[model samples]
Target: MVQMIFLFAILALMTIVLMEANTVSARDCLSGTFGGPCWAWSGEKCRRLCIEERHVSGHCSGGMKCWCEGC
Candidate 1:
């Protein structure tokens, strides 16, 4: 019974922590594809283009797509 209560208390604390952590302010960013396709796309290149050209943050995501986030 004591162990169960301890476990429950820990779980409740974790839940509260997670809830607080999840309440972060999200950026209102615009997302779109960068270049042609994933075949010749690199993270550095994409990030550079996004930062320099579009003035935003960018990354090469899955499926060979360069995702750019503009605020």
Candidate 2:
């Protein structure tokens, strides 16, 4: 029973870590200058420039830039 509990605890920890590493928010895009839309990725911030020849969605807040897909 103790071993099972330990295993479960480890699994839970791994799950939590993975989730955090993969977690990302749209705010990252609006974090700094660029003052333009961007594509956010898991464990990564928005890209500096648009990848495709498409209109990205973004906003400028407090002189900062924020962006998201299909914004």
Candidate 3:
């Protein structure tokens, strides 16, 4: 009897967590290369340039390119 109650409690908690997770807004995680020539592979530099010029979040991608989100 105790084990059954514990199992039900765990299941309820899992259901609540899943429901709450689904309610949150999803991000446009897909990023694409943007901006002009980027010779150096710098995350901070690329993010700064992207936010300065395009007004969006960005990161340094492979091949020393600046990839921006929602671009």
Q: Write the per-residue lDDT of candidate 3 for residues 5-42, one digit (tens) a residue.
A: 99999999888767644432343232333556545456
Name the regions of candidate 2 deviating beyond 4 angstroms: 25-71
Q: What TM-score should be assigned to candidate 1?
A: 0.41
Question: lDDT of all the models against the reference?
Answer: 0.58, 0.42, 0.57
Q: Write the per-residue lDDT of candidate 1 for residues 1-71, one digit (tens) a residue.
A: 99999999999988876764443225322235455763343767777766865656666443455555555
Model 2 over residues 1-71: C-alpha lDDT tens digits? 99999999999988876664443344334333343433233212333232231325432222223443442
TM-score-superior candidate, 2 or 3: 3
How do the candidates rank by lDDT, highest first?
Answer: 1, 3, 2
Higher-scoring candidate on lDDT, 1 or 2: 1
CA lDDT of 31 in candidate 2?
Answer: 34
In the predicted model 3, the residue pairs found to clash are none
